[model samples]
Target: MKLNKAFTLIFLSFYSFSKLLAQTDETYLFPINPGNKNYLAGTMGELRSSHFHAGIDIKTGGQEGLPVYATKRGYISRIKVSTSGYGNALYMLHPDGNTSVYAHLREFSDEIAKYVRAAQYENKTYEIELFPDPYEFAFQRGDVIAKSGNTGGSTGPHLHFEIRDEQQRVLNPLHYGFDEIKDNIAPIAQRLAVRPININSRVENRFDRKDYYLSRYGVNYAINDTITAFGKIGIELLGHDKLDGAANQNGISTIEVFVNDEKYHSQIIDVMSFSLMRDIIVHYPYDIKVNKGRTYHNLYVDNGNRLNFYESKANNGYLNIEADSTYHIEIKMYDPYGNISTVTLNIKGKAPAKQIKERIDFELDRISYQVEKNILKVFTRENCEEDANKELSIYINDSIKTVLPAYFLNNVAVYLWDLHEGIPTSVLSCNKGVNISINARAIPHQATVINAENFIVNFPQSALYDTIYVSTAYEVRTQDSLEVFSIEPVTVPLKSSFYVSASPQFSHYQKDKTHVYQTDDAGNFSFVGGSWSGETIQFNHRSMGEFTLVTDDTPPVIRPATEKNYYYISDNLSGIASYTASLNGEWIMMRYEPKLRLVWIEWPEGMQNKRGNFELKVKDNAGNETIYTTKL
Candidate 1:
């Protein structure tokens, strides 16, 4: 690799910043920079695929081997190295009852590196974790602990740093006064949303949520439209934050909502618990995130959201608008530096019309239903003029469980069922039968077991944040050329995990080649390793989706090293399980990063043999292996 002059200058500046940190006396020095403006690639509370980001990411100028320093006098309490998730991480326990963490490291300091290698060799595994004695690997403030690199789940070269309280709650690193960082820019409001709480509620005279555009001028934002809403309504927002010297967007520090000059909602993301991190799914608009790829922080508490960071004065962060009343709405966002951006809008309440809506037109025999936030809304076609007040029946295992009166929405008869009571097997209305499709009800705070014809699922008591209406169907064939057990409504996600056991639908699949797979919307397969007991294979999974049982006899592909730096690249359809590298029939260390599908040699004890026989062995998750050999 080569670097332009500008890139070379930035690389030099990164090293200079590290050298400056080595002399700093600050109580909590920036891990990679001190006495200068520290750039960030990401911030605490940023939204991730599964949870909120636990820490801040310090930029390393697109280069590796930047020295990472200890922010406080502490001992290395824990160290971990793995192919995924914060590869090469170090945790230090300080005297002040707080823990500091540095992740995505290239290598530890000299003594720590030696210790990690000896333990890895002794354990005969590249990935390992160690808890040292209380006083081992102790260091003073500003002492180098490791060098930053792109490892683990990192997308680029940066250092992931964090601070945690004694209870393991992730605290915002910016809460500790670090002069190495400076930000004066206010967060920018991306979009504003208002939700109609119920059927009686309306936003802009429509019984649905509405999104409004925002305009900004420095620290102020405005919604140009005067929103017309009635009954109960709530607000949400999407936004990003900026720092002075970095061209990166980050998470806002705080979000507050005000109605009629009184504070209605407030949430400050200063600390987070890993145990409760999945509450992010409910804290934000999950549907909007899944559909639009935008994370909108709710200005009101959502159902099943159990986070403790929200504070409000009254009415649980909702506005009750009466007829002919005007309410001024304001949303304020704050960055860690106290920079403020205020968004303002106005709402006027109006009474709904008493006249019946225009008759809707739809196919007379169509019926469908989906669950949202534990409410099952069933839509069925109905006659427009002749007796629209029909009763819909709910059935459980071929028995009539209950009946619900019809409500008309868009000329369609609708039935609503609160799933907390129980899940129904099917719904009947207007001479049409709508199967609920769910196999069982997995409720929170209790273990649920379901043994169906094709598969058996064991739902742990902790597997659900709320009730899940479980549904599954078997398909004999699909594009994957395998037997599929489709789990309907993959839209609803589980906070924890559940175990699923199933016997192979086909007898031809051998136990060795047979593995369970979770399929995506596009029909791609991700290997879910399973253990067999007789003919049943069981696996633990955190998601509800289409599962397939098939034989994978393909081996991983090993790409030749494109660089002269002894790099080896490899990939597999079922995912790489493990790999090993040896030179001259002697074991040597190989660093593997799965994200890039690359593995590189790390010589032991500084061995520099000019000529040798080298072999790399790679294995796929399905037990297929590939070997590559070369003479150097």
Candidate 2:
């Protein structure tokens, strides 16, 4: 058995060594200064509004035509120019199969720029995609290829640099030995909070309870007092980390916590999917009033939620402060390059106390909404849903308000509420089948248009004349002609003083009961079927107007070198293929199975991808195409 184990270990070590050797050889040998600029607008693996930033933003300082160079030996495999997204983008394929992308470019190298300009003039359009043969434009390391500028969706002048695999998956550039960046400053601990969410119904500190607070006594962070609770409790914190030499404070790259020397929770702000951005809400503490944004990097794993990011076991981030006499809590934060900072906290256990003087109500001190005093006197608002079913107490200036009954709507509740001096009054449960209306028009507020139908409405001063009301679920009904309502525009000039009503645009969405149509900016009302010329029309979801059909049976041409024989999984590979499909005016989802070299498609749930002999087009990343036709 010992001999077998020894042999197995030897084999694994050899494989691991080989992999490391390959990675080192693939590293960039020389620095390619994105430009001769020191300013940066963004960095690799930064937390962003919707997604984790994939690349580094090299600052252009609002200037244009600064030269960009190839980081390694690579060929120009793909070029795309568009009004949005990348504006003018170039893809370079490297020998290691990685692709480097430069986006928001003002112009390409002279040779490529001329080619693109010619194509643009010929097509009479700004958008164009080109795939030149491999011999067209190959560059050695440190060769200039493009110049940085503001284009597409960029708000200012900067260059977006990305390293991606052949599958188009972005790889963290910092992990590949991009040695220019450095980070050593520790993260700041802003607030430490605790909640007995599911423990005892009443979450008040007894004589034996412990409270945690943030204190700045040590070099980084330390806790002076201990916390002890009898039952179940959860912890939340607000904090941010700093990178050396950067003005901005960014999210901590990783956080791990230890309770009683046992691993509890771990969280890392690294790569993420575009589709799960909305799940951020569930991961963070949702403040009832202000929506105070938490980092959304929850270290504690919740039941049944399959978020695949943690690398630790035994919940290295959540602490269970039980009846032990004393417990030690340690928190460690790490930057992207693995520099670590830690804080140690001590917690002691105690028994529950019986009766004691009631502390200040946490709800009154925590929840807040900004409103004018005069607004509550005249204007009232209806709460279509129970403002609080979590049994949270409502109070103003330390006085306890009346508690109201709960009414459910489709499992939700309908209640009446009033806001005075930025605080909501005790909820008022209403009877079924009754609609309570409140007039908000009397409130001094302004409104501005948003999109085509919605608007931003802002309340300036409180007014009693405006009222809000609550209504039962049955009060709503279907209609053949839906009258859409939006908050009237407030005649105010300042952007800060304007707001819009909730649900600003309404349409009769019931397919069998109502008809609602909308016209675009061009005054063309589009039906599911096609464009219609009318000031008014009954919108039908099922009926796509009408169309003519043409048939062609010629199969799309598929290329070999760029399509059939291409292999390599690097961030820089750009090869493409194209084809065309025709139908009787329908919608479809295109699927390409590379292994089978076949294309399969399905219509959108309620729509079809069809046009009378429409062009069935397919294109690859490198701009290759194969156009074929199926006859009707």
Instruction: Name model 2 segments beyond 4 Å from true.
Output: 1-26, 29-39, 82-86, 118-124, 127-135, 195-213, 217-219, 229-234, 270-290, 293-296, 302-306, 315-326, 346-632
TM-score of each: 0.86, 0.51
Best by TM-score: 1
Give the least accurate 10-residue stretch of model 2, judged by summed lDDT.
468-477
Tell me the TM-score of model 2.
0.51
lDDT of 1: 0.80
Number of the predicted model whose lDDT against the real structure is largest: 1
- Across residues 58-147, which tens digit of lDDT does each residue of candidate 2 receive? 666578888788877767889998656777899987767677888988779989987776665455444689987663687877888988
- Backbone clashes for every candidate come to 0, 70
On the 0 to 100 scale, the lDDT of residue 334 in model 2 is 75
